[model samples]
Target chain A: MEFKNVTVVKKANIYFDGKVVSYTVKFEDGTTKTLGCMQVGDYTFNTGAAEVMEFLSGELSVELPNQKEPLIIHSQATFEVPANSSFTLHVKSIADYCCSYAK
Target chain B: MEFKNVTVVKKANIYFDGKVVSYTVKFEDGTTKTLGCMQVGDYTFNTGAAEVMEFLSGELSVELPNQKEPLIIHSQATFEVPANSSFTLHVKSIADYCCSYAK
Candidate 1:
């Protein structure tokens, strides 16, 4: 689906030395989301706001805070990360995802 | 700058085995642009519509169609490619760019 009537940042948000990258998308209602891609690698992210990570394609296993085992995600899945927390992701392939930040 | 009141595609345009990736942004004027990132590598792109590649950051050397020598680009630069033509870029570092296609 397409995000309509929003603002898109021109520059990308690069992380893990370019292993993970995203672009900021701002909605009219003052909400924000990031469309990102993750290459095959392991990554850890610290969140300020609570986030919902929705996967569009590819494969990954995520270790969320207080979770016993990593949750495996394939194409079309969603996971939530709490605010002021951290999560680890082991990307099995090239994963494309959208992360919505809670205000 | 940000593209306001636009529509952004959720998925990314992955190229060259994730060496090059972009998100498509559509404007109200029926124009479209791709906000993209390029890792340190050489990439060749064939264009259907004419394109103007505006670099926001990083270093690269571009070989456009009909050009004898490649043009070196630093942090901020712009280059044009003809429609139905191709160009090559040798990225020295991770590069962030906005690619506008001619309507």
Candidate 2:
């Protein structure tokens, strides 16, 4: 799959000292998303806007706010997180993902 | 800087066990580029097409073919590699780069 006719930022968004990296993609409708990857590690992210994370590959376990237990994902999956909230991820392997933000 | 009116592939091009990761960006005129990053490590890459590599940030020592004493870059720089040739890199620090292909 691909995103056509969009604007892609030249620089990358480096996080966790480069363990997490993403590029910002902007659509014509004023929506923005990030194509990102996470190396095998644990990370915590605080979100400003609500987000939907779509995984393309790899295995991971996510801890969302007020969740009973961590969500274990073996393969491709999608998950949502609320705005002004935070989540944790234990990436068992290299995880490739796309994250779209709520406007 | 950014590329507008382009198509971005959703999946990442993972290389060397994810030590080097890149996203393919396609232009309207049948041109292509990759927005990529490299973690601190030694890597060798062979190119199919001639490429111009533009560095966004980082420090590294590069060994191009037929050159003595690797080129050391402390910040932003650009390097050209011939098609069907190989180059080696000793990434002293994480490097973010954009590579454009000749067509």
Residue pair clashes in candidate 1: none
Q: What is the per-residue lDDT of model 1 for residues A5-58, given as tens digits with 9 covering 90 to 100?
A: 999988899998888899999998899999999889999999999999999988
**Highest DockQ model number:** 2
Point out where model 1 deviates above 4 Å. Answer: none
Candidate 2 wrongly placed segments (more than 4 Å): none
Most TM-score-accurate candidate: 2
Please give the RMSD of candidate 1 to the true structure.
Answer: 1.0
Listed in order, the DockQ scores are: 0.86, 0.90
Q: TM-score of the A chain in candidate 1? A: 0.97
* Every model's TM-score: 0.97, 0.98
Provide the TM-score, chain A, model 2: 0.98
Q: Compared with the true structure, what per-residue lDDT tens digits does model 2 show for residues B1-103?
A: 9999999999999998888999999999999999999989999999899999988889999999878888888869998999999999899888999999998
